[model samples]
Target: MTQTVGKRPAEDMTQVKLNVKWGKETYNDVEVDVSQPPLVFKSQLFALTGVPPDRQKVMIKGALLKDDEWGKSAPKEGMTIMLMGSAEAVPVEAPKNIPKFVEDLPEAEQEHLETKRFGAGLHNLGNTCYMNSTLQCMFAVQPLREALYKKASGAGGDPTGRLVTAIAELFKDLESGGAPFPPYAFLVALRAKFPQFAQQTQGVFAQQDAEECWTNVMYAMREKVKDEDGNPVVDKLFGMRTRLRLKSDESAEEFTEDGMTYTLKVNIEEKTAHVSEGVALGLKEERERSSVAMGRTVVFRGGTSLTALPPFLTLQMMRFFFRRDNGQKAKILKKIPFSLEFDAFEFCSDELKKELEAPRVAYKEAQDREIEAKKLAKKGPGPSAVATASAASGTLTAANAVADVDMKEAAVASTSAPTTSSSTKLSMTGKYELVGVVTHKGRTADSGHYVAWVKQSSDGTWVCFDDDKITVRTEEEVLQLSGGGDWHMAYLLLYRAIMVDMSGAVPAAVSEAAQPAAAMETEGGSSA
Candidate 1:
């Protein structure tokens, strides 16, 4: 025996005043919607008291209220109602028709399904792919994203803090799981901060360089976002220390300097088929300069060696150069290859290599064990525990003994050497894993489309973020971004340190890992 709450439809509902008594407190003139169910009325009472709607037992004139029924008489003004029961915890209801399990879908369908599941894609506002691509790459840095959200959330009111707040809100919206959305607010903030981004061509928005956008945005974040101790967040994640060396060929005198840099600039050449080659070339250079000791212009060899590696590393390829003939920045179309795993041990100074030795050995040992176990599993019968250990040991020894003779020789020929401070050190071995890339797909810097390819941490899968279009890509496909022709080539690369724990290694030895090599201090200009 249940009765409808009211004869009239919900739209016809009218508000009435009633007196509600709960415990020793009496709420006078409580508003109640007459046409709604009793549950709705109970919700109103729950608000006054701490009782939840389900736990509330309400009655009027000794008649127990039914959730669905209005009873014989409609609620009238100035009626007295008794509210009873204690607050009860309500169970959260699971959402219905969740997206299909991505793993169960076919490989072809998985990409589409994953794209839909993440519900993220940035809309391109005219030629703003550069901004969108760089933002996507920035979003891939999980720690940075979390820190920004915590610091900038709800602080969007101040004009000075609009850029950081907009970034935080945009990241929140992207993570909230919908359709592709435009980052109009973030763009407006960026343009306001850097008028260069607001440049237009004949009243139309102009295409900009993704690397330039990335650098300016990074500068803005560095200025705006600080940690509890008031250190710039970007510095901790992207800063690096270098040891600069200069030797006058005539005087045979050497001068050493220390410098800091945010991004490693790779000098690409026609022979630079790989990123390592460009890096090696970029590290050493010979230029003529005025020597105080020589009392004249003399040839000086100068180069940088890594003293410390940052948690996150950014490498910018020097593909665009100002063409003196046309007075325009033009791109080099040579193909250059990069790797998924970058071992920067060769680039480290001799001292840093010593500090990295223990962890490098440990990483090699772990890799060896995994490989041996996989091999044993594929052999049908299980190998004895002793045999497995012996095999892993042999493999580890071999791996540890491997030395890139050519790279070392090249370094010896040129002369070279190496962010964040944490209780537990990361990237102790000078190894980095590629996590994100910003690529360009046109011949010139001014007329190319930019796209981002970010590696999904949960599944270790690469997702191509081309404006509002998202699709999964294989590692091979991502690797093909190396420039060959008028195709997309990696313009900016982001790498994250590979964290591995070495049981016997002393963490303190590398505790000053991200700090400048202060022990070998000297005056030097900041590196680019």
Candidate 2:
């Protein structure tokens, strides 16, 4: 079936003629649709030149055509368009190979073949369970997994690029149905880049913290992995732009700064019982420093606010602390419960909240309509149902209308072309749902077993990845990971944004929300 892209219907399409010029070749009278989005035009160019939409730079009359806009200067009949992009050589499709007949094989061979057809686990190389667990959690990110596959297919020969390619290979092995295999090459590449992972004591590799390894691996990916347009893929998914505001009662000034972070570190305190409390504490802090405004030391209250939220959010629970007596990091077995659905609206700045309000309202209305439709569906078709069929028909029609809008928005979001603005491409609603988690089981941070719990996309059930052992777990059992005892407690939580049905047209609110954070410092020993 032919898919209709963009907001306009097929009947509204207005085709025009344009002359396309690439490197050394010029094609005359190419058909162009003026009614559709610019991305559609780029896709047509890709088919002709073998150049991906993200890599193509299409210019008409010296004005660049953006993925999100059609531009004020419209294309006319027989207009010349300049396209500059390198055409990538396409790989030929390979024929599938047939495996040996399972029925004629021995019982053990058949069993092995059966297990290989299922999702394969990772073999623990010594105390490498931490790495295995982290890998599993990372693989749970569908977008990241997809990106890794693309990188593996057409990656550079650099060390970081090799590392990504190796990871993709490992992931492919795991998914190809079979027994657990050692991620030897991936580990070698990782240790080569970050020597800290190769630490040893008495000729034996020592156990390391999973969070540290996770941080380092993510840092490497952020530095190396890029989309077709050469933008960091890691940052586009997991990075957040934050603003730190520091205020003091003794001074009439606030010092503010903006920075990027991949994860939010939540410090577990004595009074912390839930993850939300820890997150709240993580956003605010008190520090005593020399106040330049007062010419004396004074206490300052500092708070961090989200300037922009990414599609994926990572929260690291500070479960370990350095013990002064033992000189080792000890774990905090405090019981902290985290909700499946997290609302980050409260943590956002006032301006961001205002910007998110409309989208949130739209999402809530859509959900309510769905719920009403479900209720009507459950009522069944009887005499009573027939009595209110006309009334219920209206609700169903409205729900279908909302679904149509949502489908169009999803198409826009799934486009591979780069948008004019990154903020507009992000989640409209500051809400997320827990998808993947890394948990620890031991008392000390230095030596503990790590496990990954990931929600399967096919079925909403949770699966536990324990090194070479894999088990299906219920949602309730997964929630029990909230620490109260020595059992596995969540260490790293990955949340995916709950997508809101909003299109790129809503930019006024987004730009208004993106205004730079206010900052005021002592100017010439006095407030301005």
Candidate 3:
């Protein structure tokens, strides 16, 4: 004998209702879901009362609701909840699929954009989100995109070539104006590279590691890339090479060690709370028993020297571990706070600190220029002469550059560094801007829903790609994905170096240093 209850559609299964109350006012029914987490719920409340998520305090009876666990707090049928917080800003919807303006964009991005940021989503077939999210996040890297989609290019008959072709085909699909498609070709290319991914688990597609997929993608991209020296361009493109030192406990720097890493593993213990802290702690020294060295028990300390920084750097949160009780891999529910700007100055070796100096100077100068321009804009369009004089004299006005900028009739237009051969080589190492985040919402490594949150490089807008449903989100909501509870914990974070354009003008000293031969072209142009 068998019993069956009627199954609802996938849409209804994902959403639930809550009776919300704020003082004398009450919203008898409101629809929300765990799929997007409580941050979206707060956004919903913000819609109702014009209060921001960060300012609102939501409570059930006397108990307060945290962002990740709001699903558990809701009753099966539905329950009433209380809200407390002042309304700071008027209620407003975020940017939609079609944008309105470039008002809030950075000075460098104040121009017209052809493509909307993260306008398309990928189709998730079964438990294929693990692969989909990783692919979506990898698509955020500009160099990777350029390499894969450069016109009249074909991937040669190599293991990486197939993967490259698959990526290129998928990019075309994502960029095209239409519905999302299943990445069957990408899956085939992936499985061809690693047969284990093709294996069936319980007659279903087995979920694989996102980091492993990312590494394979990186390797494939590197194989297709070549340098002038005819060597692999892996390190120069996206590798984070490190220098390690192996020494006796009593002696310092007795032995040398060097290696390269594409990803940094954030080891978690019950004690650590933040991602940066975990990374700093993970770089600590270790003692091991060795057979070769006279100091049988050697103290090996790994000091990471940033020999080269790729356009994109990826960090993985070591969330899954082998649980002895379950006899299987289990997920970590630790909430590790990440930042929009990540500082890695403490982690860099002495030499790297010096290498990052020039770019830092260029960035500072560019920022100062923006600040001065904004100051002039605030004074209103009276004397464009004074602003032009200031620009020529290289002087910074006594005004701070805030987001509330009015660029109407400004003298100098802000821009980023030129696309020179060495542009990627130099950047502010300490400052890393968050570009893409891949999150998983499940208890085990074997199965779960994976989603990607990608930032639009043109404007500071975030779009969450959950399978085929693409929704724009706020920075407040994206920050909640940093992970504390079981909902959607950020598993991987991708960071890119922060570099500003010098407003279309390169420094005379650096320009001369960058290319001595290019100077001959300038003289020839003058003669002509």
Best by lDDT: 1
TM-score of each: 0.67, 0.68, 0.64
Q: Candidate 1: misplaced stretches above 4 Å?
A: 1-113, 117-119, 154-160, 287-289, 380-427, 504-528
Between candidates 1 and 3, which one is better according to TM-score? 1
**Whole-structure CA lDDT of model 3:** 0.60
TM-score between model 3 and native: 0.64
For candidate 1, the per-residue lDDT at 321 reads 89
lDDT (10s digit) by residue, model 3, range 440-485: 8989888778899988665668888887767788988888987778
Tens digit of per-residue lDDT, candidate 1, span 375-396? 7757765457557756554443
The residue ranges of model 3 lying beyond 4 angstroms of the native Cα positions read 1-119, 150-154, 227-234, 250-253, 287-297, 382-429, 500-528
Cα lDDT computed for each candidate against the true fold: 0.68, 0.68, 0.60
Q: What value does the lDDT take at residue 183 in candidate 2?
A: 71
Candidate 2 per-residue lDDT over residues 1-528, each given as its tens digit: 011222334454366678888988987877765765576577667546767676889988788889767877568877888999888756888667967677977774465564453367787766888899999888866556666776665666565776677788877877775566667667756765676776766535678888888888887777666666566667766776778888888885677887778888787899897888888899897777788888988988989988666667899999999999989999899999998877778887786677677767756765665566556667896665554554544433332222111111221212323222212232356777787899999999878799999876555678888988777788898789999899999999988766432443322112111111000000010000
Model 2 residue 118 CA deviation in Å: 6.6
Q: Candidates 2 and 3: which is better by lDDT? A: 2
